[model samples]
Target: MITSYNFYFCYIEIHEDYVKAVMKEGITVSPEHNDVLLQIVEKHYKNIPFVYITHRINSYAVDPTIYLETAKISNMVGFAVVSEDPKQKIQIKLEKTFFNKEFKQFDTLELALKWKDDMIKKYRD
Candidate 1:
């Protein structure tokens, strides 16, 4: 498990098949935050399709517009955001339309990883 605090509000963790990010409570997650994540993913893992899993542990706001530019990254084959919040669930539904890659929300990390594995296989095939 690789871990680093890219920003005081955001902590980045890398796994074998994906990256898990945790943000400090109530911070607005914007394009700048997404940019840092993309750079980290590009720098550590290469040549194989992988996932960006946001393990939401705190209340925060996200800019759905970032999805447009995020979709343009070919290596980012899927996005798995794990959350159990009802309010965030609604926001996630709205964000889905802007995301070009496979996107889903889950209640647990195990399920999210399973979906990520399946997506990677699907895209590679």
Candidate 2:
């Protein structure tokens, strides 16, 4: 089950032994606006080895630097995005450069889930 924090637009899923968080639309990747996001992630996911991020996060407006910084602090297995827009090709290229080995951008949520599952198997005993 996914529990949502409507105020911050984040969905949290608590498993038997792990937690997963999916950030919804309009998730600000700026330093100033990330306070709530940081808090929520820290509260529920700080110790989780695997975290998954789905949909609506491929916007060109997001600051890659800020996003990368947040991801680094969280120490997630990686994040997978779902975006098929042709306009986002360049943005994906640039984001890939920034995230490098820490993130994977995909065109579908299924692929993201698969990636997360694989990570869980590889990293989580």
**Lowest summed lDDT over 10 consecutive residues: which window, candidate 2?**
14-23
Tell me the tens digit of each residue's lDDT in model 2 across 1-125: 43555445455555432334455565555676456656766776667675556465423356677665656654466666667776765676776766634576777767777777887777766
lDDT of every predicted structure (CA atoms): 0.85, 0.61
TM-score of model number 1: 0.92
Candidate 2, pairs of clashing residues: none
Model 2: CA > 4 A from native: 8-28, 57-60
Task: Give model 1's clash tally.
Answer: 0
- TM-score, every prediction: 0.92, 0.72
Highest TM-score scorer: 1
